[model samples]
Target chain A: MKKLSKRIIVGVLTLMLLCSSLFIPTAKASVPYDSYTYNFWLDPVESPNPYVPKDEFTGDPTTMGKFNNPQDLFITKDGIIYVADTDNNRIVFLDTSFQYIGEITTFHNGDTFNKPQGIFVTEGNHIFVADTENQRIVEFDENKQFVREILRPETELITDNTSFRPTKVVIDGAGRIYTLAIGINSGIVELNPDGTFQGFTGASEVNINPISYVWRRYFATDEQKKRMELIIPTEYNNLFLDNEEFIYVTMGNVDVKDYGIDVIRRLNPSGINVIRDFGYGSPIGDYFVRDQQDITRFNDITVTDYQVYTALDGVNGKLFTYDYDGNLLYVFGSNGARQGNFKNAVSVEQYQGTLYVLDNGNNSITSFELTEYGSLVNNAIKLHYEGKYEESAENWQQVLKFNANSDMAYIGLGKVYLRNGEYKKAMDYFKLANNRKYYSKAFTFYRRQFLGDNFGLIMTSVVIIIICILGLRVYLKTKKINVQKREVNGI
Target chain B: MSTYISTLRYSLYVIFHPFDGFWDLKREKRGSLSAALTITGILILTYVIRRQYTAFLFNTNDIKELNLILEIISVLLPFLLWCISNWCLTTLADGEGTFKDIVIATSYSLTPLVIINLPLIPLSYLFNLEEASMYYFFLTLSIIWTVGLMIFSTMITHQYTMKKTLLTIVGILIGMAVMIFIGLLFTSIIQQIIGFFYIIYKEIVFRF
Candidate 1:
């Protein structure tokens, strides 16, 4: 009896241990995890910020905070989330933790939203909504009270029959409002805060083919010119205001032949692109993607306080992040139906170290928190852009230890070597990263070194060739004189 | 077959000794029209294959998006137009070379391009990013050789002085431009006429 009891007790202990081992792993797996599709770097899971609809959206449409096809999300400094509940005709407000705070459903004198597609909450807590279908902008105060409505300004600069349907709006620090209205290929329509009309800003420059340019200038009659398509600027897709109040715009319809122009632009106050390129190639999209349709079409952009901004690529449903100098830091998110993937990534916003991407296809927001490697990449890129080359190189090297295929890390190391004047090493790294600009610069230095090393041999050969040429000329002249003397003596 | 082979082989010698090669190619009928056309075809084939199979580092064309027929037309149209335009202008300048001679000389001039470019296409595959300059050097060398042969053949075939040959070549370029302008005008006029009839037909049908 004593042996039987001991055996039973041992068996029960073994069973308990097995059950605990199995249950612990499942519990760990159930915890929110970060997952992102990688092109060049392996971004492991840190944590996931999975969100469900608030209590108002749980059941029926009788609640104030319910969202219907929310198209955009903007987070303020204090972490208030402003969502453009597009189909619901409201802007649902949420606190830092995504709890339903309140919403703006109606405006002045019983007017309400006519599909507000964009929402921007300024530092002073003023709300600006692109009341798109209604052809007006609704602004409200911090107290959730209706302030004033700004209609589309009638200006002489606006060509005849220009559509006033605004889709996105942004305000600069100087209280200048820029609107990207539909069918306005001219550019972003600028307006004063007091609703006065200003001119367009940062219009896409017209590209004229040289052959057709000559034909149009010299051959086409005035009547033929009238029938010709006006070489207007491409339309602006979206805009974001950076910490410096500089406007960053994304043009989705950039053609293939505009060699010098990028689809992404950081415009200064004077409407000039001021973003510098430091080893990072044009931060528009994947530069080497083979498919023409795979080119990134940025629908919206979110510029963070860290000077690292992200653009939401609608075509691929991906998020591409770049630093202030337009160096690509990381590319993550994708088009799919999984936990972190988005079907239609319409807008991306950064708040408190997490990215909240609003998906229009599924009408939900998927948030991505930075893993350890993600934070390391961000810190490395920030240091590199801050001109701390050596320190950033160390971080970039660490990143390479984790993900050897990190092209951005290779670029970082290339820039470091370039700054240190190690041209050969810089050229190797730049070639690996496929950066032609820096590669040529390094090639120039290498060429100088090669020429310096071979200067003696080159000069000797050149002198020998010159001497041989002169000797041949003299020999030919004497031979001719001999022939002439022979002829005269025979005569 | 032997004659064709000899004429094509003579093109190689023509590149080196252009004065006599082009004179015999026209006056002695050493180079035939079929041989010249074959050379033209080979040149076009080299261009198309080079674009298609050159190493990615040295190539910028998207191969998946390449339309073979359009690429061929884009090359052949300009080349044939240049030949025609040059022949027309040379005739007006009282050149001795016939239309066949001009065609044969122009096509034969492209032999150097084919000879250098065809070998370099495969050789490009062996090049690293840093060694791309070697490939580009051969490319530039071939272009210079072909242009030199073209000028030489033009001078010899037409029996013109160097200055007159240069002037006639410039005139040929101007004549090409004029041809292109007239072609575009004709296309536009044809399109407008078709559009007018289509509109009238639509109106008549809709009113009834």
Candidate 2:
């Protein structure tokens, strides 16, 4: 209950902070909160994340290894984990049992990596390695052996430095790969199965450092589409692969040099949906719970049915959790610069039956068996990209057969379940990824996604809360009055 | 038309007789016309004494000044008309009184447009909702004008008022509504007839 009060107080303060007239000089002002018409943050990095990356880790977050400069992480269905061991210029793969696999430093016979940033595994063992320094997406065969480049003459997708230093790789169920191409103008690049450009969702100032999957789907009716066509661009970053969906992205990592953002943004698939935003209830400056400032500085994010998890680049090798309704659940880790301490807890992945993390500090992989939040185990991204979600959750039970701890696979399944509208499964994947703080925070934000149109929902909720509070007060008052009456009657 | 000319001749005779025979009408009609025209110059000084403000209210900025001017014109012109309409009615039609009778009848005729519009204009201010609300005032004023005009017309013509005047006005409005309903019902037929003649005229002469 006290926690609830703290949340409400924080919500009000954050709103006031946003409303406070701090002049952003170069910013040409427009209506804030009206996501329908604003552009994304470009040309600058404002703040650094407070948390340091866990450069070393072993199995159970209880242990620590000795590797540093971990940038991104992903877990496969069989509980096999992959980390973009950034500084090493290599992509590392590990199994659920904390056993190591041969690292794929190059695609085929070439030094395909300058700074390897994002890694992914597709159905039938097709692995995608994003050689960011080389500015390309490389493909490998099932044996983890080298293959040729998918999209050469990067010109088609890069379109200049806007797509420089590509980040995470998100693929649709249909085997199509998308990368968060980070640059002066950041965007998610969609690739055909043959590895060519599928055009940007939409570009120009609105999309800056977009970090998520971009798809093509329609969310509004024809009449509403005609009306908003002039205002909201047609293409959207299809974050969630559902027909009427949006992919949420985390921006402003301390890993990079941008400030101001410790932020989150969502876009529709096909690109036109450019609603760059910060989290709901952006904390007022900083809230001091203890001696340290509680910063919601967010890093990587994965969506679940009942929640979304964001890795805190701050403290507690923690994954902040939120319910789908955007309620803070828990921060599932300890606070320290050691193993299990969420030291710069940078990346989280869910696979098969477990959640995985690259404890960059311990230089080892760890997995947690998934329990609650519905049947996320079986639904993989393949089901979503294929648009065969009805049968999506079916393949997971058998696939977890290969490895008991495939974090990336579980995260992929979790996303597929989310696209299929299984939010509980989504929540489980988020929790497994060690992203409880982000989960709770994003869950709280779900309430705001439709705020202007959902006044009735908020009013009902507020009225209910107020009534409960008033009812409790009245009950206490009535009991006191009865006692007083008895004393006056000399009973 | 000739009678109208004669009525004006008598009006000049009355005003000049009451005031001064400034020019010799016996010498020539032109001299009388010239003297009357010359007399208008002396009255220019009266107009110079700041025109009276009016009571008409309008919502649109474009029409506010125009409406005020129209109100001034309505008040003063009808007053002038009152002076003359009565002179014409009594001197020519009734042939009962002199210029004094004309003044009295003309004042009575002008009362409905004035008295009702005076109270009606300020009530329009209560309709504060910018443009459409002015139309509401206009509709209200028309109903008032129609009913008030009927009352004044009956009163000036029959010399009765209070209950008798209003009941008669209500009856007139009801009769007018029925006539309007009939006209509306036949409007399409009327339009067709007009179109038919226009089309025939266009086809024959205009086309050639």
Candidate 3:
């Protein structure tokens, strides 16, 4: 028994060592990158309206993202603005002079586009949308003519059972661009202009129901698809850019309330070291949710010299403005349908001196002349770390008046809770912050605090205990054998 | 019947008994972890061998060969694992039988797979077997292999009722599915993240 036990111990330990040696390199693969943080919020002054047919108020089911009703806005070198005109299922391009340069329709091709969501233009003049309806993206040339899709629903196209459902497309200055596709996991696919799966992002393993998940979860705001896309942090919604320092993303596939935010994320060029996040949207969206959870579900992003604008087509309508510091300048519109109000303001963009919003239910695009709203609040971090709970709470109280979905308020409350010996309340607030969908290193720190390091320590201790029991058993058996041998020899 | 077939069949039938007294042993004992551990250990060893001695594993390609190899390995892998595990179960745990007995018993395990998919293979020969048929073949093979593997793994894991084993297998499959989905999910994010920042990074580093 003793000898047999020794062999089993040797075998198990050898196996563990072999496993560590074999899989360790993969675990240790170090792709070094320096990540950065960026502030993305709703710029309310520009995006206007809350529009639902008085009838939609009684009916329209819950939905979100680049879906029809146009939430995002963008302009071209020619200064023409493009609206995803999502629900209408078309791309409406307005020339620099803000003249309507006609439109291109991609609907009725069935899978050509189910719901046309986010739209983007390249320097060379190509258009791509996060077309939710068709389960694929349709491409258009500068001439508004059909171009072959750079990507499609890759069910069988992927030889090894991999699947891809691309949502939004973003082009960087270098023209080496990417598509945020929903697949076995919600991830971004890197394609050399020719559309080869160079490598993958977000997801690598083939999911059990990857293709179905992409279809249901990835479409902008259709709940049937949303429920289908129920898995968290898998869909990439919209993208914004300001040179290379920061890239803002609206990732709604994770079921966050909206952009306030498991829906949005800020990443640097190398895609390493997530810099900062805006809101937390949902608990399932924890890894996917960003810092600014309570208020926004941003889709389209456009940046100009003076300000960066984000379209929030959440449960209500909103447009948030921010400077480089991730501070909110002003919020536009509210939750009622009006001339400036949006039922679902789906798209926003700046063309020349004018701003235009494509409201999905309003079925109208509203234009605005650009204006600068002064920076109102420094970041929550600056306030919290500086120990100004009273001031922060007051500011938060003011924000909650207009938008109760303010992540900063939640953070501020948490700080106040901690200061007042309201440990439980503080924990509650901190839990909110920690649990909101999207996060950077800041939220991760809080996550560790909330989950605590004890679980891991305990698991390790249990394993050690199991090993000790085995060792003890072996020792006792060997001792018994030794005693028996000595007694027999004496007899 | 030929000696091989009769012997194989008899050994299989004998293995189904509650316990085995056929194999020689110093003292029989059960080791549940031992069965799973051996399989896991071998997989790790194979991984090391493939990675460290890439030349031995492949001459032209790397891991992309997983799908094609899966067709044959799917059957062989289960059989080998069952043999090894049952050997440990019966010998190490005083499980019910010898390696030969378990091996023969599992030969019938493939009976269901053959019954389920037998028609599909011949149809491939009748069809062009190029475009659509090949795809159908792969799909059918995957289905048969999956069901067969689930049944085989569960039985070796324990002598629970078939219904219980089926439910447990389903649960395991769901868990695996979730794990795969999560992995793909991260990769998808990585792609988006990379794309979002790729241009920016190039411009910053190279200052283009």
Candidate 4:
């Protein structure tokens, strides 16, 4: 009886231990979507998730009502979140903790918004709403009081048949407002501080291939010519102003071959494109596509203070983040019916390393917090940009521990090694990263070192070879003379 | 064995002095068929080595996607096509070179490619991107020299004038293209026939 009781107790204890172990959570749970970045070969390589969904804001209907087809999201410097509830015809505000601060349903003199699509908040807390259907831009003060409304410009450039429906709006640091309207292919419409019309700026140039041009000019019949697509500039879908007041615009409907040109542009005050693309691949979102519909259609773009911008693709529901040099840092997100996945992601905004994507189809704001791997990469890039190579190297090493396939980390370490006069190590890292430019720079130094080390041996070999050749020639000449003398004497 | 070595060394002389070398390569039988084939094999080996061993700064080939058989075929196919096309055109143009003569002359013309590029494989490592133009200049020079040798070999081996040789070379290129087109069409037709038989077999098996 004693043996039986002991056996029962031991079995029960073992079962309990097994159950407890099962309840313990794993170190990293699987996410609903995969994160990837393009390799040097333009192939999509899987990477660790940079940002994962932390929380979502669906809003209570009893209080501010549910978010109805929200079109835009803007996070201000004060950690406030503004959502343009397009179908609700209102703008909802929330604090960083997602607490309801207030709502803006009406402005000056009984005026209201109609399908407002875009919202921008300045440093002074003033709000600029692109009241899309109302054909005007309404401005509100920091206290939520209506300051003024800028109507459509009554200029001859905008013909009478053109309907002015501004879809996106941005205000520069100098108080100049730029709005992207429907059917305005000329360029972004610029408005003065006091609501005066300025000329269009940064108009996309029409690009027609030579073969098509010759065919259309010479071989096409009248009906065929009429059926051909007209060569015209595409309209900008959304625009954002960075800290330096440069307007960053995104065009959704652009030709795949015209990716680097009109798909995304950073326009200076004078409307010149100053975007740099020193990266391996063009900043065209996706390099490999199977079909025409697989091309990335950029819906919105958000720029951070570090010049690291993330463009949101409405089609794939992915966010492509790139550095100032247009090198793609990471890509994440997808279109699915999951908690983290978006259905129709319209806008993306970054605040304090967190990304908030507004999904029109889901009618919610999904907030993503940076993972450990993500924070490491971001810190490394920031440190490198700030000229702190040593600190960046440490961060890059940490990042490599998480993702060994990260070429960015490899290149980061290569730059540091090159700076530290470690040419051989730098060359190895650059070769692994497939960065030929930096590899050449390191090879030059490596070659110089090799030649310097073997200089004495090389000189000695040259002298010895020359002396051997001379001795051989003298010996052969004497033997030839002896043979000639023997032949003459015998004759 | 001595004859083989002598004929093999004759390629070095042929590349430099095409007019006399090609004349003797056929008339005096200084060059042999085995020697010509050996040169072709070496040229193929040179291509493979250059593709794999050239410095990363100058080599643009994706190493992961490198196919050894494709590299061999890239050299061998064009070489054989040139030989066959030249033989066919020369026969019709009242030229004197036979198929063997065309093969020997064409293979001798390729000696410069092997001579220049085999050393370039290692020399590529010694230069930087800033001095890439120097490397490219030598590469271009080797190609031009080989092409010039090929033109001269054709004229001498076939005993034709410069104009006729140039015209015959143009015809050979067009002939190569036509041959490739016909080869593709033939294979595609064969595939369709096999597919038809496969479907018929499946239908018969299913019915039974």
* DockQ, cand. 2: 0.01
Pairs of residues at least 3 apart in sequence or in different chains that clash in candidate 4? none
TM-scores of all candidate predictions against the true structure: 0.59, 0.37, 0.36, 0.93
lDDT tens per residue, model 4, A1-491: 99999999999999999999898656345467889998888888999999999888888766897999999889999899999999999999998767898999977777899999989988898999999999899999999999988899878898746478888888877788898888888999998888888989888777778999999999999999899998777778888899888989888887766655547789988888888787878787888763565688898999988788899998899999998888898999999987888999999998899999999889989899999999999999899888899999999999999899999999999999999999999999999889999999999998898889999999999999999999999999999999999999995
Query: Highest TM-score among the candidates is held by which one?
Result: 4
The root-mean-square deviation over C-alpha atoms between each candidate and the true structure, in angstroms, is 13.5, 29.5, 26.6, 5.3
Model 1, which residues run further than 4 Å from truth?
Answer: A1-65, A106-112, A133-135, A154-165, A183-185, A204-234, A252-262, A272-296, A305-308, A323-330, A447-491, B1-17, B20-142, B150-208
Q: Of 1 and 3, which scores higher on DockQ?
A: 1
Poorest 10 consecutive residues by lDDT, candidate 3 chain A: A50-59
Error of 1 at B48 (Å): 17
Model 1 TM-score, all chains together: 0.59
State model 1's lDDT. Answer: 0.78
Model 3 agreement with the true structure over A158-195: per-residue lDDT tens digits: 44344345556676776555666545343555566655
Q: For candidate 1, lDDT tens digit of each residue in B104-182?
A: 9999998999999999988875565677789899999999999898898889988999999899888888988999999
- Candidate 3 achieves a global lDDT of 0.49
**Deviation from native of the Cα of residue A129 in model 2, angstroms:** 0.8
lDDT of each: 0.78, 0.47, 0.49, 0.90
User: How displaced is residue B107 in candidate 3, in Å?
Assistant: 83
After superposition of all CA atoms, the RMSD between model 2 and the true structure is 29.5
Model 4 CA deviation exceeding 4 Å by range: A1-29, A160-162, A218-225, A256-262, A477-491, B199-208
What DockQ values do the models have? 0.05, 0.01, 0.02, 0.82
